[model samples]
Target: MNTKPSSNRRLLAYALVYKYRIIAAILILCCAVVAELGGPYIIKTIIDGHLSLDEGDMTPVLALLGGYLGLLVLAGAANFSQSYLLQSTSLQIIKNMRMDLMRHVQRIPIRYFDNTPIGQIVSRIANDTEAIRDLFMSFMATFIVSILQLAGIYTALFILDYRLALFCLILPPIFVLIMYVHLKYSKGYITIMRARLSDMNATINESIAVMPIVQAFRREKKTLEEFEVLNEDRYVNQVKQFRVFSLSSRNAVGTIGALVTAMVVWYFGGNALDGAIRFGVFYIFIDYLGRIFNPIIGIFDQLTNAQRAFVAADKVFGIMDMEGVEVEDASSAKRPEGAVKFDNVSFGYKDGENVLKGISFEARKGETVALVGHTGSGKSSIMNLLLGFYEPGEGAITIDGRNVANTSKQELRKHMGIVLQDPFLFAGDIKFNVSLYNERISPEQVKQALRDVGASTFVEQLPGGYDEPVVERGSTLSAGQRQLISFARALAFDPAILILDEATASIDSETEGLIQRALKVVSEGRTTFVIAHRLSTIREADQILVLHRGEIVERGNHDTLMALGGRYYKMYQLQKGERVAV
Candidate 1:
């Protein structure tokens, strides 16, 4: 995409929604410009018409002074109104843009998040949006005012002396060339700087999130060195941008302005001394020339901010442009019957490389199916497909005879609950975490669900019980405690289908025993699928599927699989620490 134009058009579309405010701001800006431009003309009139009149009438001079004061007051009022309207309009647009961006992020598919960093996403939403706000508030305002002021100055200069006005016009094209070169060269640096900033944020977030691991491994020095490298990369790009601005911005423009002014003086000074020009006219031209260059310098300085805003807009738009891969058919919205079936379902994260190869399974209502496999044996991939996080590469998955692929994710997930190995808890009270703040799940139900999962013991022992505050990621709680709470959360939803993905892998034996009892109670009337690493846990499952290399090599209940003495038997013996040949 033509980044600059595309970003500008999108921003303009946002601003145009409040067209009346923009029109009012523009009108006020015009008034302010007129009032400001009148000042130099009034001074010229006083010197040429009043002072040289050789009149002893102090009244005319006093009246001119009063007129000048009124003009200044008018200019001040218009300027204030213009600034307020523009800034308020800008803020409104920013608010709308940010809300839309957040909503878009929510609708994005899970796979996009799998490959994209959270910190990078956060930077676009927070940091980049703020930069865009700067564009509207300061950069756009300064640019418009500078252009208007330059035009006004040239008009006034031409009226006083067309010859000098023509000379003044020559400098703008040169200024344009300087700015063009500066922006062209600085574009690559700004893009690099923004990318490096995202990298730095990602590094910082990763480091902080894994600080405990770093300390445990005694790799703090290595982490710090990695962070320094990212930080230095960003800093280097920033310095390069600064160097580009320094060479092409204010100082360079100022030098050109001075040369133009010196040329105008040499041309006009001789004419004034020779009585070929009025002294007031000469003075007015010089004053207007100075006024012209000031805004030009301001414009060049603001261009740097414009460049940054464009880069930020580019980043923000990139995310907004993504269309979610998961599309829900409206006609397929219906409640599931808890009979989950995967028929020859194959999938892959990358093209031409299947993760689940023709895997087939069925878990009827009120049945518990355990999936046992080594890592990368397609256990989790099966769960992912079942949950609609991914679509199969071949065949189909169905719930109660309805194809899951055609169903809306919201509808498919409405009757489903999941508890991952590492349960994630938001920062809230225990009750809020349990219910996930769903209004439909009452406080009584929340308490009952916690008690069912045997989490109420630890929860009630806390100082505030259900209201006890949970810090970010539930870091204040133990692993088992978090898992128990997650179990309660899933049960509180009263889902028809429950998925326990290695739920007992991280808990202590005593906690696991408590969870096992709780699990039976919760799974009694729901279609449950357990992806288990420990073989002992799934001994009582209605069916156990042993997965190897993305295919189900053995399928039966615990005793039947053990008698067969296949892959499942070998895995079972290996877990029991019994001797088994590879």
Candidate 2:
């Protein structure tokens, strides 16, 4: 009847993957507890059995002392072995969990990224996962050892004298009640703490990314004020959580443990003075009572970490549960020959709000189709649909008569490429950026593609030439150089369809002229779709569709649209500085 996993179930499942190692660690922990517990009883033997005897032979006492020393050594060895095993196993489990998160992020819908912050995603993978590492390494390991120690000590106490042990039993219930109170209070504080921490990370990532703009606009004080608010909120919650933790864990254990110890000693010691019980039994009672509170304290101490791990794992599982496009090894449909058609397609990023309404258009094989529209005219949305980044809500899209919705997204994108206005380049050399580490694209292809896109003029002049290392986002290169590299990256694939999404808008006119020449060569045998802001750039396009709002108002070549004296003509005249006010 219950469909959701238990609170600790996700953590346990990951640990179960390395059950053999964890079992070995737990077994070693038990050995350590037994060795450690035996020491107090051995001292009881020394005190009441040998040393208390009048005709004492120091020989047996020395032997008992030697035996106690050996137990101490054994406990030490077992403790080390168990710690090592658990730490290694914890690292391994965390590794697998992080890998799962990473792989899942790759498959999750791009819409999720569009909505989520980059730094918050990074926190989930980096910070939240590190906190989970503590669950296995410290919390669970401490919990298991503490439970075994408490069980062993209690069993020893009962054997010594059940009457005295009964008083110690009271500590467990009171400790449980304390933890219940602590959990009731601490969970809320910790939740706020985690959320604030994630928000801080997001803010920091954003601030660093836009530091240049912030300084240019003199917004440093405002940025710092914003970050300080999140930081202070996290600090407040953490202090509150720590207060709850302190009240429940060590302090509560100490107070209740002292009261229980006093009760057992008053009753049992009075009985001993009256000769009602042996001093040996009394000594053993004192010994085992000393051992009881540690495990209880340990349990309470780890509850904080347990709650955090639960929250973080829930966040992680939430991401994994979302629907994603399943990748296939091969596409069922044959490779398209670049005949892209949008048939009455309607789509929106949000529900009940269409961004592209009833958009019907086609670009036949090897023909150039340009989408001309003002800002927010839904040009990029069309490209997103064609590339299968999104699907139309109300209509069908087909490439070479193969329904794109039915094709695997990976396969559908395999033979298509795009160059954006602000091109993104990874931290790699010119060759690697072009090839994108695809083995099918050889070093020769990387060079040829760069040369074809006219990127070689600047690239060859650099000290490292094609092997020149690129920093993050290619900030080391000029704007035109980066754009040229993006164009070459598209050409390196030799795609059946190429999209230029305002690709030349950000670069200088001299570089634009070079790309225009290169475009003539590359567009010879591919279906080229250009989403352009500069009307002059699309003048030679085979066909142009001018869009207003979410619908096409004019569709024709540049000259035909000029003769129509419509929106496209007015936009073109405005660009050329000819007084043609619509």
TM-scores for all candidates? 0.95, 0.95
State model 1's lDDT.
Answer: 0.88
Worst 10 residues of 2 by lDDT: 48-57
TM-score of 2: 0.95
Q: What lDDT tens digits, residue by residue, belong to model 1 across residues 169-282?
A: 788889889999999999888889888888878887888888899899999999889888878888998899899999999889888888878988898889987889988899
lDDT of each residue in 1-582, candidate 2, tens digit only: 858786478778899999999899989999999899889888887666545434655777778889999999999999999999999999999999999888888888889999999999998999889889888888888888888888899888888888777867777788788888998998899888889988999999998988899999999999999999999999999999999898778998898888778887887898987889888889878877877877787788789988898777877777766777676665354556899899999999999999999999889999999998889999999999998888789989999898988888888888898999999999878888899999789999889888887889899999999999999889999988999999999999888999999999998898888889889999988999999998888889999999988898899898899999999888988898899854
- List lDDT for all candidates, in order: 0.88, 0.88
Top candidate on TM-score is 2
Model 2 ranges with Cα > 4 A deviation: 50-59, 331-334
User: On a 0 to 100 scale, what is the lDDT of residue 64 in model 1?
Assistant: 79
lDDT accuracy of residue 212 in candidate 2: 90
